[model samples]
Target: MRHLPVLFSAALMMASTATAAPHVVASVVPIHSIVAAVMGDKGSPELLLKGSMSEHRAVFTPDQIATLGTADLVFIVGHGLEAKLAQISGSEAVNGKTFIQLSDAPGIIKLPVREGGAWEPDDDEPAPAAGSEAEGVLAFDPHIWLDPENAKAMAREVAVDLGKADPENAAAYAANALAFAAETDKTSAAIAAELAPDKGKPFIVFHDAYHYFEKRFGLTGVGSISDVSAQAPSAERLGQVRDKIIAARATCVFREPQFDDKFVQAVIEGTGAREGVLDPLGAGLTPGPKAYDQLIGNLAESLKGCLGG
Candidate 1:
């Protein structure tokens, strides 16, 4: 009877004490990066689809789902940006908890899909896509976090969400948000100047992932070449791309870090345009650099090396 009383008291004390910090499972490294800045040692946070894994086609393993049970928040790049995330999250990944969609965040600027098969509206007129943006089905560019300024905004939003989840640490979350935003601004400015009058230059990306970057820095992405997230284009489609390259005289065609480079090699042949890979997922694959500040520097340096070389 005496031992039972002690055990009951221990259980009561345990129940009275506060729980551990909530865990966050991020769908993209950039999201994880920003959140990590705010979380510091406060939360258990990890990147899920990591590295070159296409967010659009990320496979949700049973082990990954098990980890999700521990997470209080799951942050995803929205608007179908995370290929099958909505489905997996709703059905399995979220573990019955709600997740935040970055695409839904305030200050997110969505791009319109041009009818002429371009990734954006004309430089002169920026209009939302037909039918979709009108109905508010897809209002914002899902890749807003790609731009450092916008990423700062996103960081604030995430901080607010985190604060709501842990009111006790609300002050820390806000402070971290402000600090990270300042850092992002500095990083972005450095990158913008490093491009050195090449913002107006033309280049082709294997995917349309960099539209937010182009919009932020006044760069022009000439065209997109592949659907690394989905099916590879057919040979005929590639022939058409070659024709477009000839017509545009683009500087170079960009590939992605995780994709097979065979098609890119074949297409760039005889065109004088070189091959380079843009890493969107960050060091989720390699652990090169994890923070947004370093990420921006890495991107700028990569661009300088690939384009200026």
Candidate 2:
């Protein structure tokens, strides 16, 4: 009976070890949605930033930093999107923690940072060559998750890393990734069809954050009111954008949920351009397996709504 108790205890411990989920952390809501989808029912990944927090301006609490230090894996958009976490995760404080930069994921297309507010054709600066620095600043557009294809690529990476970390749930993760990819494809096609009528219509965004989404759908973005940093445009800059809005016959001026709309109003004031709201972060939507689809869908609806048929 003594031996049976010992054997039972050993079996219980082994079972617990075998079934425990990996401690994974995701930086932003969109990334969290993808990770959650890939993890499926096997495990849940912890989300770092929540509810419309801009990745560029994200400020982490001390408890969040501690969470990073103890996580088995951390997924982030590396190219300076979550600058604070990126800097902290590299230090010895989180030594031995596996931090996966989905920006570096193979097959994800990265666009260069647009040089000026009005992103004229001449303002398209090429992305910095690999392994070479660009004036010690963020070089590529860090909003890779805006593109469904890019999201698919991120999901594959999350699956691979999660599978490696939790061997017991490897097959489940792989299957979920495949399923998520299919869903993204269907979602992309639907969005493309929804945005077809709005193609070639001139529009202005609050910032140049939607290049990936614009490029993916062949949408016409005449210019942005703010820089990549999302700062409010100066009066001179607003005047310039207002002129462009008139010249381009822009259909709408789109403001982001995370930014102040006063600048957008200033740009469109007396320009006869309607104002619309777009959220790239899925901030208004609940984070979960279907959040990415909802995010992309909402953006399309917003664009089509303002641009008109």
Candidate 3:
């Protein structure tokens, strides 16, 4: 105190005295969880969107950009999962910073991020111009965690990236990733077994978010309730879906965790088909240990309970 310091410079000095840990940011909850698991004590993880926030409609707040500008690494579910993430990665603040896209990782079965409508068969992929779903660009489905195998691959990639970034603690990073991968494998096996009795059965979902899930579990994506992220299907589309639901004898009508069930309920009206949520983002998802496990567990159990044994 006797040394007498300037206010601004003293503040800077105080900040300098306190160390800032390596910053890792993710675009969505699952990516955040994977990165957080890998970083463990190596870094503190920040998420741009919570579980309830739709990645498709995500916007960057000024503070979010400021935080992102300082991140050591930013994890994204690449393959055009979230268009905003690609925009952010190209920004001056993030230009050369390490941005890892999970879709490019190995062992992930990705599909074109588009919706097929009875109207035109399929629509264009979502674009970023305020409201654009034109030209049908091949955006990657960022919902990689739906398939536990992809989740394991993502964990390993996070490990490699973290270990490379912080070589001093590479061993710890590897250990965390290894442990997370093992957990993911168990989850994958459990989900497979849970749906095994109903394998090859067709089902109707609200959106196309579960393409990887269908492939993993050997089920048919009979139809969908939504035409795109921002647009709900018209009555005509719903009518076709109703016919398909009846034809497939689909026992369950699945709605996403965050969307309203009105349309799905409407589709199933008078047809004996029951409706429930199939949450990839795991709505009401608690942020703690066993939370991710519970999210997937609830999804499988919910599906089995609705569909059949």
Candidate 4:
């Protein structure tokens, strides 16, 4: 009879522990997608930035800040991508949370910020005077999730870290990660095939943000309308871009929905070049586990639609 009471108590404790999953928070939609994949049905992570807002310009609400303060784990791309969120996450109130910056993950391939309408070697750009976001003009590209290979690496790291944070669900995390990696491989191959016809086809982007995606699928972005610092190009710089487009015979210039389209239209005006919209953040798409693949597929389709015959 005494043993029955002890058994009931043990069962109740186990149930309580099982339901107590870690509170996870992600800085952006793409990162949140990967984390959600790993988490599966275990739990859902809070996405800090929900829409087309650029991470560089994100300002958290008081509720969002409070959410970060209470998070058990927070995933971010790092390398100054989410400077504001990084600051908040590093505050003393959030000191207890485990922040996983995927940029520092093993096997992550870093590409330098392309400057002056060409791929600048990483060694060529001047170093940031300090780690401040204002001085991050020469920082390595932060859109790591654009490349499926890098996404796979990040998923592994996320699984490992999530395992560490919640050991009871360790095996589930590993299984989900493996599944995500396989899906990434399959989706990447499909995207590559879809984009194969457009390989080496030159294009222009609103900003120099798609280099990782371009580099991944053998596409060539000859120039970006915006500079590495996201500054509006000078009149002289705009002239240079127009000349570069004419020189490269680029058929299409891509604009991002998050940014103003006036510059894009002005650049392509009378040049006979078509304009296409590329949403790097998956702006209007529903945010969830499926968004990552959808985002990549959308890019490929957008490129093909504009550049392909």
- What lDDT would each prediction earn against the true structure? 0.65, 0.79, 0.67, 0.77
Which candidate gets the maximum TM-score versus the true structure? 4
Models ranked on TM-score: 4, 2, 1, 3
Q: In model 2, what are the clashing residue pairs, if there are any?
A: none
User: Per-residue alpha-carbon lDDT of model 2 for 1-309, expressed as tens digits?
Assistant: 000000112233354536777777888888999999999998788989988788767778888887887776788877667766655655656653546778878788888877654763222333333543222235688878898899998898888887766777888899999999999999999999989988999999987789999999999998888766554456667777888999999989999888778888878888889999999888889888898899999999999999993
| For every candidate, C-alpha RMSD to the true structure in Å | 8.6, 7.9, 7.6, 7.5
Clashing pairs in 4: none
For residues 182-245, what per-residue lDDT tens digits would candidate 1 score against the true structure? 7777778888899866776677777667767777778777777653233455665566566667
Query: How many Å off is the CA of 293 in candidate 2?
Result: 0.6
Best-to-worst order by lDDT is 2, 4, 3, 1
Per-residue error (Å), model 2, residue 57: 0.8
| Candidate 2 lowest-lDDT run of ten | 1-10
- Model 1 is weakest, by summed lDDT over 10 consecutive residues, at 1-10
TM-score of 2: 0.87
Quote model 3's TM-score: 0.81
Across 84-187, the per-residue lDDT of candidate 4 in tens digits comes to 76665556555444367788888898888775543332343334346566354366877778988888888888898778667889999999999999988888
Q: Given candidate 4, what's the lDDT at residue 167?
A: 81
Error of 2 at 150 (Å): 0.8
Question: What's model 4's lDDT at 205?
Answer: 86
